[model samples]
Target: MEINRKIRSKKLSTRVDLTAMVSVSFLLIIFFMLVGELSKPKIMDLTLPNSCDISCGPIGCFKANRFYTILLDDNNKIITYFGLLELPIQSPKELQYGKNGIRKELFYINKKVREYSASIGKPNNGVIVIIKPSKKSNYANLVDILDEMKIANIDSYSIVDYYTPEETKLLAMK
Candidate 1:
């Protein structure tokens, strides 16, 4: 009897295949892309409060401990303040026309709105965010900010008359 030797074909070699490494790399790439997307900044949708202080008295308005005004210029800049004596808090990051054409200054406005709301203890009665747009400003800017305020859950605001509070008080007395 002759002894027979068996040789496996070199092409049939079956060591640890790299197919799993390639699949893992793909899965990792997809996971990283999804995580990066989730980390990106999102446009906040603030909910505004509905106004019930329709029949407000002058003294009642002044009785409130805090006030806030937000002004948007045509150039998409923002100016904000809490009271008559308070200096406007301008955004340190200058807001210009966003490259995308939609005014990103809206995010700044929402941040300030929350700050004012917190300062005033959430204003269960009412908190108005005055939006005074420059004559040259498009109505779109006003609508957009108002929408943002609504999303921020801040309601009870009004499109105020151009009158200064002092002027309005005098008119009320008359």
Candidate 2:
């Protein structure tokens, strides 16, 4: 009699189905990209003054008495004066960088300019700040002054790189 033999076959798969994994990974990547795009930083809009040499028509030229100049020097020193340097309404004075320093002066000067303008029948006209950042001044100093402008609610301001001979001499002193 012949003996009957039973044969067993083994099955094995070397490939894995990665469709779900790939789809999930793509979904995650898209989600993170959207989140990053949505979280972008908001920038402040800076409106510079017109480049009119003689006079500005609709905007009107800023009077010397209504102008305020802040000079940024090395070591974060701030030199501020009201009106033109030649005939300053308030003489140039060194001020520290903070609330009690530049901030206070800005508030006082703004109030004074507004009052003066109102008295002169130009209630809408206000203080105009001119920021002169010297080569020696750091970027942080400029940024700080800009922040102070915002905090002071100054609507009209400009950053001028050119310095007058008198201003250069002023920065050199102390």
Cα-based TM-score, every candidate: 0.40, 0.75
lDDT of all the models against the reference?
A: 0.52, 0.87
Best by lDDT: 2
| Residues 1-174 of candidate 2: C-alpha lDDT, one tens digit per residue | 987887878888889999999999999999999999999997765755444422536754446787899999999999999978888889999999999999999999999988998999988666888999999999999999999988988878899999999999998885
lDDT of 1 by residue, 58-165 (tens): 544442323445555555554444444223343222233443322334444445655766777873444445555655567887777666665555554555537456
- Candidate 1 lDDT for residue 39: 98
C-alpha lDDT of residue 131 in model 2: 96
**Model 1 bad stretches (over 4 Å):** 1-61, 85-123, 161-174
The 10-residue segment of model 2 with minimum total lDDT is: 47-56
Off by over 4 Å in 2: 1-41, 50-62
